[model samples]
Target chain A: MDSSPPYLSILGVFALLSVLAVGGGAAVLPETKALTVTHFHWLADDEFRDIYGLGQLSPGPNMLMVIAIGYWVAGYPGAALAFFGFFLPSSFICFGASRLWNRFEGSQWRLAIQRGMAPIVVGLMAAGTVSVARVAIEGWITAALALAVFGILLARKINPAYLVAVGGVVGYFFLV
Target chain B: MSEAAPAPTAPAAPAGPVPLREIFLTFLLIGATSFGGGVVAYLRNSLVRAKKWLDEDQFLEALEISQTLPGLNATNMSVIVGDRLRGPWGSVAAFLGMTLPGAAMMTALGVMYALHKDHAVVSSVLVGVGAAAVGLLASVTIQVGRKQLEHVLDLSIVAATVLMISVFHISMPIVLLVLGPIAVFIYRPHPKRIHLRRRHHGHDIKPAD
Candidate 1:
């Protein structure tokens, strides 16, 4: 690790990501993959996928995987910067908008904004799914696993954490 | 052009002052305990069902704001609910409590991952984990977009947004700038639609029990 990492760049990237994350962390997956793996070379595609899985396995928001990217790039400071940078701007926006939210409660424009953004957010999320799929799906086994998981999830209300664990076991036995 | 009077009253919560410690601990429990990625349900169970910090209407209202904003639903709800409870400090406490557990876990995982990433066992398991995540994300997207996908215009917009990002590789700002306004304009209010707000409000807010 560099003695003094480029904290500013890390901050700048995550801040931009925070604002652009309109539909949450999943919506920003492609962008995060693009910036971290392709643009910055901070991590490889496999590394990104692994870290994302780690995030999924943990409690709280899965987006917290961002700290891993920062840690790989520049140690503890990088980790802190990534966490604050990713969460702060969006939190402030949520805070301000929420405080002022009721002021426009009954306004048609507010309704319009919500209505208009709904589809767009959905679109963004679909794109995120595709992006992750691009990196994670390698062969028939992986593809089958993904499909099985999707089928199971849509069919039932089981906890996803269990599926994720089962996946690791399957991988340990078969993929290896 | 304005219609109903906009009340500037503070958020409609119970009159009793909530301690910041309680705010932090409540969110802390949710953060530490909620697994499988959907924090919204856990939030509703706690805030509305368990604690009654917010009534059903207030909870739904907060959820709408959280979804429409540019952040994770978990964190945004925490901030909005916390602010409603105890101002900025409450927001701080809630945000911290909601994130601390996950952050610590991710940090420890990161260190372990860094050390053993290249090991065949770790890599193989992660491969499966990542693949499973794709399914998880797809399920979430489909569920969230099920309503939007039914409408023709919304479907088109969804298609366009997906195309722009996945195929065209357009950045997010450009995607939002191009699609956001167009979609909003498409849904712009008609002047002749009087009392539409009331209809929308009823449709959105569930009856308070």
Candidate 2:
């Protein structure tokens, strides 16, 4: 682990993922999991699952797991470097793009591009959902919980924080 | 009597620049408290409700644009809001304010990981958190799907992507590369007319031929 240059790799992987991570960072979950768990073997499947859990529970973006991954690989330096490398490129890209986007704000072609993007983004997100479920739902109870959450979300307007809190309490007693 | 006649006017507060320190602190607070998967909702609550910095429609527009872009929606939203509030420097401030805490926390966890590689309590907490995360991810999927997926073609693409990735174990980059072009070609809309529906409307329009 010490010699693996895991921090460097984390930066590289996240930079790549950031570019392709359209529709939110969820779109990159499958790739990130595969690279971190399956390809690199830096983290076990369960560990990857746990890190992802932390990312979800923590404030801010769920993709903040990159920092956790970096930290796990190296140390504080790794975390700091990974955070800087991963976020800076994407932040600059977005900032510049936003400025340009405003210029074409009224273009029908721009509207068309956005329309075309909707399905692709949705498709990517759906893929991400499956990727997460496949890893997290190991048993019947967990699977049932996943489905229940899905149903609850689809049917009503429950705030997501409440759902996470309830799931945490239930899982602490039952699954843990 | 002279003092009463002079009834000194209260010193006019110096109208200086909004303190960057205050802005950074506010951003940090928003980042720390924005938990449980509702980044957008938490952002609204913090920025609009708590700080009163942005109005509802402004926040919504920023959210819409953020979702359309490639990055974390919350981060992207922060960039937009930061840019609006304090220009480019403010954007950097917001980005740092948002990410610093998570980075520090994760780094601490990493240190703990080095020492306690096989601790049961750590494992158990992670297990519990992992289970809860599944629920969170599922909820997000359904919520985003309802709002974004309207057309049957959109739903079909979603189903296909899920099946391809989950069942076939296809690489995501390849999936995106393959599907991206197809989506662009198939879903691209034909050029349409742009008309000013009302005079004096502030709709930013390109020069008409």
Candidate 3:
């Protein structure tokens, strides 16, 4: 492993990710993959892929990749810094904005802004889905599983956690 | 046009604020147990279903708003819901609630990752988890798409986007730049109908629940 001061690098990467992470953290995935795998050479492509998988399986935000990357780089402290850097700025901005939002609660502009934002958000989220699928869905088995999960979610109304659990069992037997 | 409207019955005073302490603890629990990439579902269960803090419509509206804003949808929604419930302070409370625990857990996992970078058990578990995560992402896409993509235009946008990104390997940022503005322009509400509807309904517009 490249033995630099990884904690600092982790902090810097996460802070940058926080600001540029428009739409959602997933929007930054391709760049993250490139930097970690192709440029920095800190993690191999497969390792980067695995960390992303863990981020997806674990809860909270898929941006949890910061923590995994931090771990790969430095140790617990790197993880701490990565989490703080990734989360704090956005938290502060939203906290401050909430105050301003209340002042204009009744304004027509607020409604219009909300109306305008809805579709854009949906579009960005769709983009995020594409980014993840491109990296993760490699084989016919994986593709079939993805389709099955999608059908179960949209058509069957099954809770998603259960689908993940079932997929884990199947994967252990088949894919793993 | 300038007629004095009857004084609106005092809009129900905004409910007394939820204590910041409760918000913090609630989010902490959410952060800790939010395994398997079900943060939204977890929030829906905890806040909307269990706590009854936000009615379904309110929760849905917040979800919509969070989706539009930049950030994690769950974290953004938590801040919005908290802010609506209390004030700016509530946004902090909700944000910390949702994030701190998960951050701590992941950070610890990072330590383990460094130590056991080549362990067989770790590798095996990751293999299983990674495959499952693929399933989870697929599930989320379907759920969100069904709820949000009502118009044919919206569906078309999603299909085109999926094709461009998945098949053609277009970069995400480029796809976003190209598609984001087009969605906004195409989906802009019909102005004439909005004005007519506003006039017919009078000024006593019901606040979104």
Candidate 4:
């Protein structure tokens, strides 16, 4: 069994995702899940959900879960590649685009583009939510938890981290 | 402690070169301490309120640019604000600062997860967390899309996009390439509309007759 891990492909997948993450990491969740779970078979759907949960528990961008997928596929080197692949291209584009954007300050076309992209970004976010829901929502308890969290967030100003933690405790008692 | 609560009526920050190290440290603090996903609030508090590196208008301007771009808003803001402060290397420092802490922590957690993948308690807790995360994402999407969701054209576009991706399983590139231009064209600047809108904005206010 020759098991050296497919380094180039891991890099390729994440790099593609990086560029396509218009509107942010959440916007590309379905694509990310598709590439990793279906195309590459790098992680199972359940595992993908679990890794995403780990990301939520952490303090920074929840998309840092990509590193876990990389690690699972090709160990530490893969982790490094996924991080670079996922961040660099998009960051580089943003850097250059921002410079150009400043030149067109107050341009009508700029407003047009922002207005147009807004709805599309929302749509993409909706799809991302569905992708997670497919794997994460098992039954009524999970469904109820999701609803409660959604309602609380809409109605109040509490930090979401607290809700996520409370979810874990609830799961500890109920799910297990 | 007092530094944390700098007087609200302090004078404007001096318009001088900020040290690259300070930019890095500021972003580093933001990256490490900003729990949950809303780094925007932490950023506004630090840059606008505490450090006074940018005024409210400047911060919002940076935020608009960040939101419009393709990367994470927190990282994009770091880059734009960092560049505004001290050019390209400033961007590097800020990007590194914004991502490093989370990357390190996530990597550690990844290792821990690998070691204990089959533990029943760990698995159950993760299940709950994932479900809650979905809720978080739903709330965020609603808030962000609230404006778009109200208008018919925007709502239709939003609906169409979800249908293509979630139902048809269309790849992202195809969706962007096809819909992106169409959406842009729909809202493309019309000369008459621009002229009328510009007049309303105090662009060419007339004297009282």
Candidate 5:
């Protein structure tokens, strides 16, 4: 059990995902789930959902929870590696591409790319929804909780932290 | 705050770059305080309304670049806006300040979860948290994708993408390879697409025009 191999795998998987995450973290959720659960078996489905929940609970980018997967596989070093693997590559891309993009100030192709990618991004997001649902919606109780939160968010401008808290309370009483 | 709000047409000064510390602190504040999600709104308030570091057009331009990139808009915006304020070092400082707090927090939480892998109560609460996340992601996708989803052709493209990935279980790269170009071509700069582009005119995605 020399642990470095899995750690490297974690870095490799997330670094690859960092670039391919075209519409941000949500767009890559299904692929992320696939690589982590289906391919690498690094996380169980439920575990993956729970870790994603941790990211959502935090204040910054929701994808930061990838740290949990790394930590689970290795240790503190793994957490550090996950952060590097996930953020660095994409940050570099944005840095370089933004510089290049400015040079194409009037390029019509830019608009076309934006228009073309938008719908496909939406579709990827829809699939992302399903990926979370598979792990989150275990039974009628969880499903109802999810639906309630969805309806509340759509209907009001309330902060979601409160909704997530409400969900925990509901689950504590009904689920456990 | 009023003093900080620059007019949209304010000229970019060739004066000394914004102090790197100021860029770091502003993003640090945003990273620490922005809650739940919708970091974009927090960013707008701080950068445009409060700090007056960037005008509305500049902020939106930075935002558009952020969204068009691959990572989370929060980090990407930090990079772009930070770079605008200073340069690569500014981007580095802002990135560190923005991500450090949340990264530290998640790391702690990850450690806690690992240590208590089978805790009955912990797992129970996590189940609910996960469910709530699903709801949040759903609303977020709908909100962001609303513009792209309204047109029939666009809607079909969206649906086809969902089916290809979710139903067919096709890997993402292949789907992007085959469909990404097709979708772009369908919306290319032909006369019909030009008309459609006009209909979608004034959208920030085509800001330079």
Candidate 6:
């Protein structure tokens, strides 16, 4: 039933995902995984995991990795499409909503909405954590690494990028 | 009027419009430096402590708007905070700065990955990186939600959300549609207990003294 050019399909998928990303990229992890891996066949599970890892190594938003996905599927054009399609719609929404929210600064429902959505956001984040873990926490070694990193982080405020790099060194010498 | 006029300290302080170049460069600095996913702390240090662009309340207000929107809180916060200081151009400037570095870096890395998919070292290292990232993502999620997870009602909603998404495999739009209003209704503003305004954003999580 696929009928469109690859670029258009890529654009359409992310553009829709951009709007549906209500609580942030993590909130939409399951859907994003489903779209890119299951629906579009853009990447395999292991490759997706690797790309997600690469995205984390970068400094800004985690989901900017979608650009990588776009690149894999359709080269430079696909990457451009993903960058524009994925970011534009939501950026516009954030831009417009921020102004409107400020304009109605004292709206009666503002607090209520913020408070109510808080738990939902938490739940979505947890779901996202689980989704990532399902793919990444494969064996005893990875599970131990993930657990160790988790405990260290919860206990203290160390920068994670360093830890991730150290893990690559560990993997290079031992896991391989 | 009581509600419209924020407390004596209006946070952003509006202190005349900031120069657009200042806005762009500062955000660009944040973009280049903020590593891992800890941009929030870096943002506070730069924008609030250093530049005095927003007071605590103003920063939290903008944070609420960022978290409530569909994009990443990082970029959304940049755009909103930028707009507060300047205007549309400010929003555009901040967003560009916030996203440009990572986008360029990822493009280069992805291109390299595409060229060499079968390199044993790359795959192995990436596997380790991916595993470590799971831990980091999990830690970030817990830290962000620690407050919301404390209460029983909020706990249940969080559980419901996780269950529906992870276990039941419900679509996001459906899940949001069904649970969003219910969550809000339970937390609906009650004027009778006017004590609600104090910790709206939970920016500082110290237990009440």
Best by TM-score: 5
Superposed Cα RMSD, model 4? 5.2
TM-scores of chain B, in order: 0.85, 0.77, 0.73, 0.85, 0.86, 0.84
lDDT of 4 by residue, B106-209 (tens): 89889989999889999999999988988999998897786444468888899889999999999989999989999889878987656543443321111211
Candidate 3 ranges beyond 4 A from true positions: A1-3, A6-9, A20-22, A25-35, A38-40, A102-141, B1-17, B48-61, B84-89, B150-152, B159-178, B188-190, B193-209
Which runs of model 2 end up more than 4 angstroms from their true locations?
A1-4, B1-17, B50-52, B191-209
| C-alpha lDDT (0 to 100) for residue B150 of candidate 5 | 59
Best by lDDT: 1
DockQ of each model vs. true complex: 0.79, 0.59, 0.40, 0.75, 0.78, 0.75
Give lDDT per model, in order: 0.87, 0.69, 0.63, 0.85, 0.83, 0.82
For candidate 1, write residues B23-136 as lDDT tens digits. Answer: 999999999998878787788788887767887778888888987888899999999999989999999999999999999999999999989989999989999998999999
For candidate 5, write residues B1-209 as lDDT tens digits. 24455446544442467899988988988897776878888888888877777877788778878888888889999999888888899999899889977888898899999988688887888888888888988987777676555589888988898899888889888988988999889878765666666575446332211
Model 2, B1-209: lDDT tens digits are 03335434332221344466756777787788776656666677677766656776666667657766777877787787778777898788888788777666666666675577567655555565666666667666666566555568777777777777777888877877777666666655553323321121222211111
Residue B142 deviation, candidate 4, in Å? 0.7
Give the clashing pairs for model 4. Answer: none
Sort all candidates by DockQ, best to worst: 1, 5, 4, 6, 2, 3
Q: Which residues of candidate 1, in runs, are more than 4 Å off?
A: A1-4, B1-15, B191-209
Candidate 2 residue pairs in backbone clash:
none
- Model 3 interface RMSD over true interface Cα atoms: 3.4
Clashing pairs for model 5 are none
Query: What lDDT is reached at residue A160 by model 6?
Result: 86
| Tens digits of lDDT, candidate 1, A86-141 | 99999999999998887996788887888888888888888889988988999999
lDDT of 6 by residue, B55-171 (tens): 766776777788778888788888898887777899999999989998999899889999986788988888888888888878878886875555788889999999998999888
Superposed on all Cα atoms, model 3 deviates from the true structure by an RMSD in Å of 7.9
Docking class of 6: medium
Candidate 4 CAPRI grade: medium
Please give the clash total of every predicted structure, in order: 0, 0, 1, 0, 0, 1
Candidate 6 chain B: worst-modelled 10 consecutive residues by lDDT:
B200-209
